[model samples]
Target: MNVSQIKIENHNPYAVSFKTNLREYFMNAASVEGIPTVEYVSLEELKFLNSQSKDIRTGNITINPEDKEEVFKALNIVDRGEYFDNETIKDAIINPTAEGMRKLVGITDKFTFERVYAQFIGLKNNGEYDISNRVANVLERRFDEIQHRIFNTKITINEHGFKPKEDIEEIKQKNESLETTVQELQAQLAELKAMMVTASTPKKRKSKAELVVETENTTELDEVKE
Candidate 1:
């Protein structure tokens, strides 16, 4: 492998989405973070930090254990393993597209414990929390399932392979037959309706010519009697 061709191995694509979910989860924490101590996306604080760091995009920070604990305590957040289990894994498999599963896996694969801890510290003063290690381990396994499901193309739907031509022809024939039957039935119904209309109307009375013929025969019979 050429040294010049080497790629930075730690580049992660879904970082923005991961960070957004983390913010939401932190807001929901039952501890200190349960209520917004301040507004989300503290622009002033981030700007100050950005000014201090050489790499503003991923600024460095130092966090002590006590600080970690306080941050975790405030967020009421616990270790990754504390929250994840076999049942959770099963559910994650069933709902692979879930945001929580995606975020958990993204955080684990994208960021280091120290770096993540620093991020938490940047937002708060207290520390006693470390989610990176636990999240990384649990998510590593969970993400494997997601990867398998995504890449493994063998599926129930696939088993029924796409027979588009045959299936379409079958449907087309059924539709044509049904249409013909409907047309024939409609014609028969129209004929029956015409017959019913004709039967319902009264017949006209005898014509005047027929009445005159009958009157002449009656007069002849009267004259013969006289």
Candidate 2:
């Protein structure tokens, strides 16, 4: 009953012939009234269909309502008619990437970030003012992708030992240790210098005392001779 041994014929309805036992089992399982019709689909088509079904089950991309409101407020659409054309606005709404959204704003005599955002809102609200959630979804996904890339790049750099904070801290600790060692050495040198001074002072006093004793002895010898 190895299913892999079943011969799959490449024809309309894509016939699959199993062994006698399997065939008998299928026949018995089926109602005697009518045979079920078989449909054939290509592997590629099946994969495509599965992917589509998965996406539907997962649902389309969605951005938060608060985020949408923030984006709209940032755009500041004071006069909607000033910056947008019908077709360009529609295109921006369909594909709402930063660059794509910029096109909807059109060529302006004066342009600013806020102004560009405003134009984007203006375009979305142009006809029915009913903006698609898909646009927000696209924007949210794009921003998430960008943030993820930046986070990964930072991690990669850190793995290579190129982290700024860690390097700086290590260098700082080394400098502090060096400074402590230098201070200890200086303290040791001062102690040695003090010992040398103490030792030399006693030798100088002894030499002076011996000279006086020698002078007194010589005077006594002269007196005794006289």
Candidate 3:
């Protein structure tokens, strides 16, 4: 969305837009933001009333905990876990990007946060604090959910180690199948060992009757051969 390419509809062909980038944008009448958001930019204001006159904290519109709480009740959100990742709400206040907003607040989408941020900026520059009802409805949803959890305090939404029941069941079944296979293999090995032992046993030799060869010069085996 380039501002240069946009062509405005001229209800009256005689009206012309003046070009001036040197002056600061401001308004107290029908400003560029909020209820009577009639213009794309504000008109002009006193030198001290400029946004540059305010400090970093005071100048910013209410975007998060660090800024004012006019836009919404963002300060109610309390990050319980390591979801902050060592980041403070000030980071989100300074730069209300999707990720920063997600970390600060438990909201999933960035569009609503961005919309609220626009209001933050608009109000900062003396714009209106008009909030759309649609955005307002779900704005504090995360805060409410966090308050409902545990000890009724805000917390980070942790989505970790979530597995479907089917996957867990499959793993359990696989383990059972493996155990059964091992048991079968052990039984087969024991049977094979018993068979080998039976086959390898030597048959007992028949007891030879006492053959007493009374010959003085011949042995028992010589008598048998004769």
- Model 2 over residues 179-200: C-alpha lDDT tens digits? 9999999999999999998887
- Give the TM-score of each candidate: 0.25, 0.22, 0.25
Q: Rank the candidates by lDDT, best first.
A: 2, 1, 3
Output the lDDT of residue 133, model 3: 36
Mind giving the per-residue lDDT tens digits that candidate 1 earns over 1-226? 2211211111111122113211331212113332211123333333343344421232112112233344334434455532332223333333333344443344332223223333333323333433333333444454454455442212222212222446757988999999999999999999999999999999989999989999999999999999
Position 17, candidate 3: lDDT = 33
lDDT of each: 0.39, 0.39, 0.37
Runs in model 1 lying further than 4 Å from the true structure:
1-163, 207-212, 217-226
- The 10-residue segment of model 1 with minimum total lDDT is 5-14
Residue pairs clashing in model 3 are 26-43
Q: Tens digit of lDDT per residue, candidate 3, span 104-197? A: 4553334333333444344344423343332233335544554455223254433322223466578889999999999999999999999999
Q: Candidate 1 lDDT (Cα, whole model)? A: 0.39
User: Candidate 2, overall lDDT?
Assistant: 0.39
Backbone N/Cα/C clashes per model? 13, 2, 1
